[model samples]
Each structure stands twice: as C-alpha cells, then as structure tokens.
Target: MDSDWRMWSRRDLLAEGMGRRGIQHAVEDGWLVRARRDRYLASTAPAELIRAVRVGGRLTCLALLRLLDVFVLTGGGLHVHMPPNASRMRSPSDRATPLAGRGSREVVLHWVPLLRSLGADDPRVHLVDALAHAVCCQPARHAVATLDNALHRGLVGEPEIAEVFAALPSKYRIVRALLDRRAESGTESLMRLMVRAAGATYDLQVVIDGVGRVDLLVDGWLVIECDSEEFHSSWHQQLKDRRRDLALAQRGYVTWRVTAAQIMYQPEEVAAGLRGLLAARRGGR
Candidate 1:
C-alpha cells in the first residue's frame, strides 16, 4: 500500500492499485466499514476519529472559538476564513449543512492573506487569525483581552500593537479608545471605559481628604473604585480596599466599589446605580 493510503480509505486504496473486487472483499472480510461513497474506516477506529473522517474538515469558526474559550455571543453561524490565493477546497466529510430560511445561511467564508503564515497548532496564532476577521466587537474589553493574550503569550509585542493601532482608520473610535487604554489589566481598562461612557466626569487616581489615591473621583462627590481580581486577589488587598472605601465615605464622598465582573458583564446595571447616586446628590444639593 502507498504511504498516503494509510490516511486514505479502502476505496482510495482500490482506486490507487487494488481493484473494486479487492475493496469488496476487504469489506466482506470485516476489514472496513463503508461510511460514504468512496470512503471507509476500520472497525477499530475511535468514534471521534470516525466522525471526523465522516464529516471532513468543515469545523466552523464558532465551534473553533468555543474550543478556544473565547467569548462569543450566540445566534451567528460559523465562519471560517482562509488565506488569500489558497485553495478553497471543501473536505468531502464536511457536514456543516446550510439551514433553510433567513438565518439558515451556511457558515461564512473569509479570505485573509495573513493567514498563510499561521500555524494551526499555535493557539495565539489562531486567536490573531480570528481577530483579523472581527468587524465589530462590543465593550472594548474583548479587544483588550485579545491584546493582553497576544502580549502575554508572546505572539505580539507592544510595538506591534501600537503599529496596528496607528494603521487603523480614524472612524474606528472604539478601537482607538481601546488602543489608547491598553492597560495591563483588561478589567481595569473596561471599568474605566464604562465609567467614561456613563458620563461620570471624574479624576483618575485622585487624592482625597482622608483616603490616599483612589481610582476615580466624580465631581468630588462620588469615589469610584474598580476592583480587579489580579490586584485585589489576596485578603490583605481586599481589606485595604474596604479601608480605603470607608475612609473616603467618612470624608464626605459616596464611594462606589465595582468588581471586574460587574464592569465586564453588567455594565448597564452598574451605570444605572451610579446614575441614581449622582441624581440623588444633585437633588440634595
């Protein structure tokens, strides 16, 4: 048997050298199970391997994203992007069938020339590949995470990120904002954006009467503290945060402490609460 036939099926082997009669004999002898037209798998093959062989290599972006653990919203179909000028051949076993209706469209296909240099085994390269195709992303935090991952994994450096930022179009304000505030902590940067978006005019890292440097001071009335898991992970840091909040409260400032999760996942709720506090202060004044 040819070396390539090891990865091929009995029918492929027959096509290469063995006749159709040999393939039929092999099937009858329980050496292979016919999975599809011109396709066969050994009976001892693992279920996953068999399934992969049957479906071909048509895994879409969504499935791959889930496997990569990237945050993705529901409802969008799978998208697979290839490199420009590369062969756009669909595997024979790809089973990602199209739906029938408005939302029943098949997975999307994108061609990016940069993908040619990427290695499939490297996850950081895969994430960069995915980000290259992302048109719009909400809450700037996601981009921050991707950037942080790229940096932390050594896939890209600070200079590279800066270069990409400089090349972006002027209309991409959100992207620019994210690039400008690319802090070491994604949660901190996200919270800062959320507060700014909510129109909470504040001084960052402001000094107060009693408290030392605080995260934000809104009109000298509200002190907003963004607690990230990385910085405030230990009990000592948690106690320090509480003490700072109490000291600020004693100094006539209403301290509002928000966690990373609140900023990343529940921005609207936090914004509403801040708005209520600001309105109450305005009414009292």
Candidate 2:
C-alpha cells in the first residue's frame, strides 16, 4: 500500500516504537496527513477541515450539524472534545480544550473528563460535541440542527437528548430549547432564525394558495426558501425552484431564496435584504 495510506490499517504503528519524529517524517514526505500530533490519516482527510479553517475553524460544529442534516447557522472554530488528562499530550497546534470525554483526536478534540461514565455505544458523544461547540461558538441555530440531525440519524434518541440537556452548562438552556424543536435540516433552521431575527413574521411550512407548502412565509406576502447545495445543486432542482418562484410571483406572492452559503456566512446581509424588500412591499414601492 502507498505510505500515505498506511495509517488506516496499521495497528502496529499505533503501538510501541512509534515516535513523533517518525510521524513528522511521514507527514513531510506526504506519506501521511497529520490530523493531530499523534494521530495521522493515511488518506486524504475530510475536506470539511479545510473549509472549517477557512471559516475560522468553525466547521466542526457546523459540519457535525450537517452530518446530522440539522438546520443551523454555521459559526466560528472547530470545537473539539478532549479528555482533561489528554491536554498535556496535545501540541499547541491541536487547539484542544478540556471537556468531559476521553477521545482520541480524529478531528477536533475537546477534553472533558465526564465522558468516561457513558456506555461505549451511547450516541451522547456526538450530541455533547455538537452542543458544547454550539455553546462556545454561539451558533444556537446550528446547535439545534445538530440535535435534529442526531435524532434523524438514529445517533441519538429522546432519552439521549434529555441526558445531553442535563449535562449542558446552565447558560446553554436557550440552545437546548431550540434543539427541542423539530427541524427538517440545519440550513432551514438557520434560515428560520435569520428571518425571525430580521423581524419577519411568518408561519413555517405554511400552505399557500398554489405554491404548496413553502418553507417560510412572511406576512402572507412573501415566500422564503432555504436551499442546501448538497441536495439542491442539481440542474433539475434549480429549474424547479425557479419555476416555483415564477409561479408564486404570478400568484402575487414575492419569493426570496437563500442558499446555505448565504445563511451560514452572510446571514445579516440576507436578513437585511429581505427586510428591505418586505418594507418596500409594505410601502407599495
């Protein structure tokens, strides 16, 4: 096998005789990609890491939310869960923090000592990771999305959610409540929060006269759609959305569509633009 691909299947390398210098050489030679100081990936790591760094390393929180297909606004830095004792072993570059868990660095690591009590099969790990990151990052919508995704993926159940809620810091009660609400996807939830923040009053999943169930409605005058590129990037879907917009417009309902990028990165701009448009409509301008 290629040296770059050696880390995945080599249990022996993870054992004795493995030193930092050997790992560093492997990284320098492109034989391995360093995910953390002691942890290496023999293959290309998840592209989300690069994206996360670009967005200020906030991708882990949002990525985990996305993995759960929950609705959330992406926010700052990769939040990692690391065991308290593991901090001494990590390099400064790892950017790890102490949390309640004992996890090896696969992605971001948060060191929390409490993770030891949970059963190995429990999905609370993912929930705690997402929630802790969300609380730290202030991506309340994204936190909700992660929780929704966890529920949808069967990675977490109702009881698990309760456990997570109980474990959360007292300040994160708002995030916990947001997570309690059912959401279809992280993108949608983020958009909803954005719209609400913009002072747009509308019913979610409201049925219009002919537009079917729109994702969001604004004062019975506008329809807002949140598009996730992963699912809506296809030409057919784009065409369909355009058709739907045109049909909605013909029926006297204004349509505004927001993409995941806009919702995640430029939320204020999106909200401001929508608010301006709504104001103009109200003024009959």
Best by lDDT: 2
Instruction: Give the least accurate 10-residue stretch of model 1, judged by summed lDDT.
Output: 116-125
Model 1 lDDT at residue 141? 55
> Candidate 1, residues 1-285: lDDT per residue as tens digits?
222122355545766786888778867997765544445666654333333233332222343444444433333444544344533233323434322221123445544344324333111224444554442333345565555544544656666665445444555446644543334345545556666676767666676766787767787688777787878889999898889878877778787878877866787898788778877887995
What TM-score, over all chains together, does every model reach? Answer: 0.53, 0.62
Local distance difference test, each candidate: 0.53, 0.58
Q: Candidate 1's error at 15, in angstroms?
A: 28
Off by over 4 Å in 1: 1-80, 85-109, 115-158, 165-170, 182-184, 203-213, 228-240
Position 81, candidate 1: lDDT: 47
lDDT of 2 by residue, 1-285 (tens): 333222231344545455657756867987665544234455464444322222222233445554445545544234444344434333223425332242223345444444224332121235455655555555566666666656655766877677666767777777666553444556667777766777778677777776688887887888888888887899999998888898898998888888878877887888788879878987989
Each candidate: RMSD: 8.6, 7.6
Best by TM-score: 2
